[model samples]
Target: MPEMTRIVLAARPEGAPGPESFRIEQAPMPEPGPGMVLLRTIWLSLDPYMRGRMDAAKSYAAPVEVGATMEGGGVAEVLASQAPGFAPGDVVVGPTGWASHAVVPAEALRRIDPAAAPLSTALGVLGMPGLTAWVGLDHIAGAKAGETIVVSAATGAVGSLASQLARRRGLRVIGVAGGAEKCAYAVETLGCDACLDHRAPGGAAALSEAIGAAAPDGVDIYFENVGGRTLEAVLPRMNLHGRIALCGMIAWFSGKGAAEPMTLPAVWRMILTRRLRVQGFLVFDHFDRLPAFLAEVAPLVRSGEIVWRESVAEGLEAAPGAFLRLLDGGNFGKQLVRVGHDPAGT
Candidate 1:
């Protein structure tokens, strides 16, 4: 029998995940049975939500059990098919885990048109990350044109799209990121009105000053991706009846900053005084919006009007290390693992 390489959860980490927490192994090559398709993974997406899945704590989704293949989204090519409406050589995007190949039900896969955009984009924009940005900004935040919007982790996959979407809608967008280079990408490439480097020496104080300068009238919508200090800084600048789309919180996900106590009383007071509406969004629950999101965002991406970036790590063995870097703010853009060679030359 042929073999396939996979990465599995070797153990749970006490704090931030290390290379020791994951194990690389070879398994029997998966074969399609009835109503199934054999997929060869080309690109795998590493997202912040996977951090929550690594822990044993309860969440909206089940955790990846110790010794099980780590769950993930991937772009793949169908090698064989036994189901209707799907055929061999079709490229697809779905939950294929951290493996070189996958045997998934045909119903789980969504075919991607290679001519429409880059195949790797199925794991970034035009896929889950794009869907997340759109749903949060449109549905949860109810963003309006001319409103001032703040996007944290603004150079990341979700944040990049979120900030761009707001800018396209005629909103004044200010982005908060870790370093000067990312801040530049947010402003120059992603078209944010202004971007602040939160990793500077003065940290949150510097961010406050930048936000004040960028959105002098006060922020009307906040797309929150990093919760810790960034959230604290944005609260004081919020306008009356401001709306916040509380997305991923990569700051405390690894337990690195878990010891720091957040002063919630001040936050609550601001919520009361500003009459803020903060809503936490889960992309899994909003899959129904994928069609609508892709319809609107795809043309813009294809025409180069909306730009996105990706940081790719080669091979399945790099998956664990790449994911750890993603959790630590080391990734420059959307973190993707090139598990296998894409036939489309992506």
Candidate 2:
């Protein structure tokens, strides 16, 4: 009998998850039912939002219950289909969680053409993260040419695309990343006007000064990802009537440093005084834009006009470690876990 391997959440951590939080086990392979397809996961996307799912806290999405398979999105190869328009060997992208195989409803899966791009990219640059950067920048932030924008986590999955897109729109982009190397990549590769190392010794004050120098006219837009110190640094620098696309707050995902209260009154005052338009968004709410996003970005990706990067963990068992590394600022780009062999060779 064939077996299915999965990683489950063993425990929720108080701060910064560890390997002990996950457990790996094998079970009988799942069978597809009516309107469903049995898929072999090819690429599992590891994102900062997964950290929030591990906790039992109330949020826009429900938490992954203890002992349940850790939730995630992935690209998979269809092994068997019980639905129309899908067949064996079809590659699709959907929520596959942390498992070697899954039985997903056909409605939840979108078939992808491997000939158009790498299979793994269906989980990264061409998938949810790509859609996120597009919707956040164009729809939410309403970015304009000649505007000064600051992108936090500028070298990571979403930020990388956001930075590049901003530059293409002729915006002056100042990127905030963790290290000198990532900062350099933001400017040189992502085409940011300037990049700041948020991990630099002096904390938020130093980062704020750098942002000031980068955008002497004040920040017209802020693509917020890491929200702790980076948010603190960019708030006071925002130009009057600036826009903020509130995305992930990875810095507080593990609950670390969250006990230290931010001065809400001060932040509220800045928002009111500057007339900032801050909008918190979930990419899931904007799937209607996927076709348009693909129409614009797919060509750029194929033409090599828009580039992306990934940090992949080779197997299912490596997911827990890789996820912890991601929270610790260890991943270089979009983090993914490759659990099954790709029929379309890389």
Candidate 3:
């Protein structure tokens, strides 16, 4: 095995992840064990959910143990295979972590078509983020035609997809993002009816007024993200029996959920008086429906009906910066880091 440099958890941060909490170290290429595959990572994905995994507090998954690799999603080309289902050169999606390479059971990952779309999209639009918005919108929110849906982080991975999907389903769409440029992209590229800047002064009031006008009947679906002020504003505007799909919270991720938690008392009032539904979701919980989702979303990617965007960082050394950009909502769409070029890149 050759020497490979990998990022490991040096220390857990008290708030947002900092460079000191992660360190790059020399590690030996891991040989595949029985029923496992050795993978050479090509693209690493940085997502806001990673903030939860960095802490020791018990949650949906175990925290990254000290001295261990920080967990993340990545696309890898098979280097060696001890499993029958996969072959060398195959690209797959896995929890390859913030590392140059890894060894894991092939069952944990789904083999992907590098030709279907950019392999990077396997971590973005046609992948987890796509599935997230689909399941949350379709199953949880029950998004319907003619109804109005409001989404935050509207230019982001999940939010962007949710906006597009809801529109295709015939729903009127509005998006909330960090700045005027992002708002413009959401309305122009992502095909939302309107977009509001969360960074604008009196942004919350602006969002409320925008929703009030766009949804004179009241908002039918709230694609919740950026919890604090955004939620506070969206709460009172929810229509009778509207739906709330909890997505990313880039707001809380920026300050480590330390600034203030947004509790929706007004929303509860709407729930009681209007019979609204608020659901929190994780994409993994809906893995059962992924094949159906991919069936629909994959071709959209190839035909370019569903566009994908990515900010690709240079190498394994660039993971820290990618992680920072994602949490700060500095990225436009999906956040990605290239550990090295894929054979496909050539």
Instruction: Quote each prediction's TM-score.
Output: 0.97, 0.98, 0.95
Kindly give the stretch of ten consecutive residues in candidate 3 with the minimal lDDT sum: 254-263
RMSD of each: 1.2, 1.0, 1.7
- Better-scoring candidate (TM-score), 2 or 3: 2
TM-score of 3: 0.95
Model 2, 1-346: lDDT tens digits are 9999999999998787899999999989999999999999999999999898888896889999999999999999999999999999999999999999999999999999999999988877888999999999999999999999999999999999999999999999999999999999998998999999989988888989989998999999999998888899999899999999998888767766563246789889999999999999999999999999999999999999999999999999999999999998899989999999988886
Clashing pairs in 3: none
Candidate 1 local lDDT, 1-346, one digit each (tens):
8999999999988888889999999999977899999999999999988888889987898999999999999999899999997898999998899999999998899998988899988888888988999999999999899899999999999999999999999999999998889998888899999998877766666678778888999999999998887887788899999999998777877775754336779889999999999899888899999999999999999899999899999899999999988987989889999988888887
TM-score of 1: 0.97
Q: Which stretches of candidate 1 lie over 4 Å from their true place?
A: none
Superposed model 3: Cα runs more than 4 Å off: 254-267
Locate the minimum summed-lDDT window of 10 residues in model 1: 254-263
Model 3 agreement with the true structure over 1-346: per-residue lDDT tens digits:
5877789889888876788988999987888988999888999888888888888888888888989988888999998999999999899999898888899898898998867788888899988888998998999888889999999988888898999999899998988888889988988999999887766777567767776786778888999977877876677788777788887666776464445465567656767986877788888889999999999998888888987778778989988877877777778888888997787772
Q: What is the C-alpha lDDT of each candidate?
A: 0.90, 0.93, 0.84
Which residue pairs overlap in candidate 1's backbone? none
| Model 2 lowest lDDT segment of ten | 253-262
